[model samples]
Target: MTAAEHLLAAKSFAELRGSYSGALFIIASGPSTKAFPLQRYADYPMLALNGSICCLAEAGIAPLFYLCDDSSFVRNRLPLLLQALAHAQHLALSPRVVGSLLAQEPQALDGRSAYRFERVNRLPEGGEAMSDRRFARQARKDPDFECDFSWFRQKPNRIGFSRNLDKGYFSSRTIPYAGIQLAYHLGFSRVFLVGVDLDSSLGRFYEQGEQAVKSRLDGDYEDYILPCFRLMAERVINPGFQVYNLSANSRLPAEVVPKIDLDQLDALLAAS
Candidate 1:
């Protein structure tokens, strides 16, 4: 199937809203994920982010949904992306990634349930607040340049977790933010984050030496990631919507997201 054909068959975010009522585990590419026992959680749904799909693929388990918000990863790691497509039952791709696949490898999205999502600002009121001249200059130099620091620190609620993904998902220069929004939209009240270590220097568990993709997490932390998650915790984490961090060594403080061991996770699942 062509990319267009796959997109035509893809389900909208609205269609998935409140469609599920179970716990969800969001798998990231952090090194801590290597220790995660996929066998124990095989019965539950999992969302694989970027190269983390390889972990599930290796374990012979298909991800309930595969999400890739980075266009560069799509372009530089076509083989891995194709592997993800093969292992994922459904895909949630950012507009930029879709454009990259449409340009370079439309056939990669073939024979899969795929959906496209927009990357919007943290708040609905103000979009990316870049000046026209600056936007034009950046656009002229780099097609992928989309960052602007104009209104990043304007408010405490700068980071948004979209309840309605049809509008878009807030981007924090990290995939987990989008994953969180996707989980919420899918009606997963209990969200478990697996392998979101958030330390750029440590690198990803799936990549080694030259195969590693450069991480922007460290640089984006102060301005984007920290504030984003902080607001997310304050506004989103509640009895109705609980988020737990499975990575014990994660750089994110337990205050923002409570850390849980495997036994605790099992207990929570059993109780739920």
Candidate 2:
């Protein structure tokens, strides 16, 4: 069966809609996230994306949800991903990723953790799917070209061709954007982002001393990363829901989303 078919047969996310009306912390793997006080927000619901799991584990912080969409991560770093899986209560992945793991090593999904599988559409209607390098060039010239996120406001279980360009819940260029959609699906009223520095030069905190993965930070940020934030500002943030950038040095503009320091976290939570 296709990933879309699997999503159709799986349990609906409606049961978790608005389940967590409190604050949510989304941990990105950016180097700035290393400064975040994990223990301070230990009780808060947290979602860790990709390599951020390494730092979270080192800090003895276990995220509630672990999210990833790239199949290459599974193909190249299966052991690390599995290690992170042990620390998360739930796992969210794309249907393509699920299929890849099941086909390569089905034991990876032997009911060790709860799963939320989403259909990922990299290409939207009326657009040609281009390479990353080419897409970035186009995005740099066209500010209007952005991934659509309207599907997130609808019921979660309804399955169809939910393009990332049309539905924010579907996979985008970055996993953190998908994490935001998951947080909203679970009914979080406020979302906080940490370690989303979007700086390629600084690299990832977990890979500071070790061999670092090659990154297209400059292009990807200008093209895909920044647009995701802009989309959130326009579509997701409202009286019903708000997203805050907690990384003080994050590249995201304050106009897109308010940036707050860790010291203000207590006050923010209290006000919430």
Candidate 3:
């Protein structure tokens, strides 16, 4: 069966929608995340992306959800990935990853780690094309222009082209974008992003020290990162949903999503 058919066949998949509410913290594997005050936000639900699990594990912070779409993650870091999966209540991953895991360990997906396999369609719908056109127009006016994304207020059936995950809930350029979409689908109104540095040069915090992995920040900002945030700003934030960036050294522009300091989190949580 196809991935979509497999998803449709799974009884738990539909029920997984909107399974979580209230505030959410997304932890990406950036170098700056090492300094985040994890003790402050320890109580909130967190979604760990990629190798961030290693750092969170070291800090004794168990994430509620773990999301990884890249098959390379499984190939290069299967042990770490499985260890995270064993702890996470839910896992959003590609079907290929699931297959690979089950092959190595037969009991990997035996209802132990709630698995939600990804389904995607590469072709763009008309609405996505329009968002792309609109973004392009705005970019032509100003190179660093950030789209108002008010169009998302109308609840466009689709959000954007290029890097947006609206079409099939497929991963765009980064795993965190997919994590953001999953958070929204899980009914989270307030989302806080931690460790999303978006800078490739600094490398990942988890990979630091003697055995460091090479940075994957070679992609162009306009072609990869900005489009994903633009979609989130439109589809997720413009409609009154909140997303805050907590990475102090993050390369994401403030106009895309406002950044909040770790010290300010107490006030932010109380206000929520």
Q: Which prediction has the highest lDDT against the true structure?
A: 1
TM-score of each: 0.85, 0.76, 0.76
Tens-digit lDDT string for candidate 2 (130-212): 54444434443433233332223321211111212223253446677777777777778889999888788888787744567
Residue 270 lDDT in candidate 1:
93
Worst 10 residues of 3 by lDDT: 155-164
Question: Residue-wise lDDT of candidate 3 within 183-214, one digit each (tens)?
Answer: 76667888888888888777777675656665
Which sections of candidate 3 miss by over 4 Å? 1-13, 122-167, 209-211
- Lowest summed lDDT window (length 10), candidate 1: 142-151
Best candidate (score: TM-score): 1
Q: For candidate 1, give the lDDT of residue 260.
A: 99
Instruction: Write down the RMSD of all candidates, one decimal each.
Output: 6.7, 7.7, 7.2
Question: Given candidate 1, what's the lDDT at residue 93?
Answer: 83
| TM value for model 3 | 0.76
Candidate 3 lDDT score relative to the true structure: 0.66
TM value for model 2: 0.76
Which stretches in model 2 have alpha-carbon errors above 4 Å?
Answer: 1-10, 119-170
What residue pairs clash in candidate 2, if any at all?
A: 18-187, 148-165, 148-166, 149-168
